[model samples]
Target: MSEPLVSIRSANLFTPNGTRIWKDLNWDLFPSEIHALIGESGSGKTTLAYSLFGLLGESWKYDFLHWDVLGYDLSYWSGPFGEELRGRSIFLVPQNPNLAFHPYRKIKDQVIDFFRLGLRSSEDPKEILELWKEMGITRPEEKWNSYANGLSGGEKQRICLSLALLGDYRILVLDEPTTGLDANTEKWVLRAIRKKSEEGKLGVIFISHDLRIVESMASRITIMKEGSAIESFPVKDRKIEPTTEYGKELEKARRFFL
Candidate 1:
């Protein structure tokens, strides 16, 4: 509604072998909204996410790329502009949180580094500690001093979430944020995400294979298959009984979940 915070048009991405993973993508992400990129494995959801942040693997590249995020052409990121864009415009919470941290560094040090890199504000440390408490990390102070290797998978995920939040970028791209969390932790993280969306400080692109979670969290859903978007619509008005193939797939997925 308010001039899409992120816009992509006729974008195509290719693999190292010159295989096209995704092509002719046209979409827009607006401020204060949550958009879900839904698909099964190999559907190119994560690939698109990486492309949006200009982090696509060396083997892959885009054609006719035009990404304007927060009024800047992120698709052409290079040099100083790239550094500035990385810190200010987009923040990514990768799928594997365990890989995001430095094994030798304390959690607090990593958090501080995030701030020092201009990805977060100076007040991030204190705010993150508060979020850590909210995420059910007991003795938050002690946890802050702990190394990445010492924390459990769920704990690591929460730490990543905190880092993303602390950065406070204009847009946050979460790639399967609930991948390894237990049911309770999943709910907790979901609650925190809902709160973040409500605050209206950032737009979110939630990528997940869990259709149920996407149905519940995303305002709009893009159903992708074979590395391309086959359908896009408002989740609330999905109408499970539709006759289209994509709608039928949604129905089948819903039934499987139920």
Candidate 2:
């Protein structure tokens, strides 16, 4: 109904050496909608996420027919608007949480830096603790003063989530949000994401290799293969019946996870 929060048309992305990574991408995400991009590893899911935030590596090149977000063409953003867009319009929750945090800084200080740079507001330790609690981080106050290098993988992931939430972003790109967590921690992380989405008109592009999780969280799902989107379907479209090749593979994956 309202203007689509983000739109991509005829988008083609390539890595250096002229290896095509993603081609002919066309999609629209509305405000508050959760769109899932599912595929096997190396299917360009992360590449798409990086490109959206203008974080594509130097080796990669893209032609964005119409890549617009919040009424601006992202490809054309420069100067202060580019800086503003990074924190205000779109945020990325990286797959590897360890890559996001600095080992030398206290975690709380890192959060404070995020708030100062992105939010242009002072950090509220109380608010940060509250979000840590909501994300199921244990000993929030104690952990706040510790360095990221000291936290476990799951703990680091939660901290990464807190950093993203500390900013005011309309859209969040979650790249394999549950990759390294144990089952229990995975559930906790997923619950936190659900809670965050509930409170804001947030558009999310949730990327995952696990179809079951994608089916659970996504309103619309796109299946990618070999750097291209091979199928796009609603999660409720049907269950894996094992009657087709891809369907058979999907069934096998489900059974393996089970």
TM-score of each: 0.89, 0.85
Question: Candidate 1's residue-wise lDDT over 160-253, tens digit each?
Answer: 8877766667788998898767787778777777777768557889997777777778877777788778777776653323345875776587
Cα-based lDDT for every prediction: 0.76, 0.73
In angstroms, the error of model 1 at 102 is 1.1
Candidate 1 Cα outliers beyond 4 Å, as residue runs: 78-80, 124-126, 237-243, 255-258
Residue 192 lDDT in candidate 1 = 70
Per-residue accuracy of model 2 over 148-248 as CA lDDT, tens digit each: 87888888887777766666678889988876667876776676666666678778889877767776677667666677776666556534233346645
Q: How well does model 2 score by local distance difference test?
A: 0.73
Candidate 2's TM-score: 0.85
